[model samples]
Target: MKDLLLVLPRLARMIGSLLGDREVPLSAKVALGAVALYLASPIDLIPDFIPFVGYLDDLLLAAIVVDGLLNYVDRSLLLKYWPGGAASLDTAAAVARRLAGWVPSPIKARIFGGRRHTA
Candidate 1:
């Protein structure tokens, strides 16, 4: 608990930086906007002042947004700015695979290059 408390400021700064960065994908920007709005709201889906479980909703929502945004962004772009975000690309790929489900090989190839898969 103490450890998390110590790290919360740093995490907030990172999220702020990501939100302010112009190079982040449109989807990422949108997700960040949602997060910002949620944080600013006086009423939340689950209030943070409660016990440990109070944060679960926020954590899960953040995860889903980050995962979805990452799917639309190139790994290189995230790597260039948020170094840790690069590592999350694999998780994003898995999420994309789950969400997009078997993109046509030809369309995938066309979008990504000569030969490639969406995930």
Candidate 2:
């Protein structure tokens, strides 16, 4: 819980940067927006009233969005808008990966598709 409290602000800043970045693709922005909406909506896969488990879905969805955006967007562009240093970025990525691990492979594949390669 303490760890999550620390990371959430940084993640929020990163999301803001991504949304403001002109170089980021529309699709990525749209995906992020959807995630935000999902978080804000009263309805959820797991209702917010359920204590710790309630928030898990929101965190998982955020991790999925961040991971997918990292894969889809140019690393250079992402780095450009990232307010944090390389170490911070790496930490954020690691956190996202850890959260994503809780999700099944099939669901990840369905949401993110196959691995994307940059030219």
Candidate 3:
């Protein structure tokens, strides 16, 4: 419970950072923002007074958002901004690549999606 509260922000940041890019659809961006704010709030669907089950709803919500958004969000952006999570992301990508190499196409499409460059 205490641990969940502490890590919630980091999880939200990772989701936001991963989804924060021009290529990301407006709807997805909005949804991600909403979820982030919801997670950061003191109140929740399962009230904190409930003890063990209090945080379940939040965890479920985050999981759903993360799972749904993972396909749409540009993961490279996540790796760049959230360096600690980057290693795990890289490892996952590597495993995915190795296991699914037979399938075609590149997955590095948004390596720079979150950046704002000057001309």
Q: Which candidate should be chosen as best, given lDDT against the real structure? A: 2
- Return the lDDT, model 2, position 33: 94
lDDT of 2 by residue, 1-119 (tens): 57666767877887898788777677677878989999999999999899999988998998988877677677777677677777777777787888888887676555545455342
**Candidates 1 and 2, the one with greater lDDT:** 2
Give each model's whole-structure lDDT. Answer: 0.52, 0.77, 0.53
**Each model's total of backbone clashes:** 0, 0, 0
Candidate 3 residue-wise lDDT at 13: 63
Could you give candidate 3's per-residue lDDT for residues 60-119 as a string of tens digits? 555444434444455655555553566555544444344333333232223223333221
Candidate 3 whole-model C-alpha lDDT, 0 to 1: 0.53
Alpha carbon RMSD to native, model 3:
9.4
Instruction: Name every residue pair that clashes in candidate 1.
Output: none
Instruction: Kindly give the stretch of ten consecutive residues in candidate 2 with the minimal lDDT sum.
Output: 110-119
Cα shift from native, residue 12, model 2 (Å): 1.5
lDDT preference between candidates 1 and 3, better one: 3
User: Could you tell me every candidate's TM-score relative to the true structure?
Assistant: 0.52, 0.82, 0.52
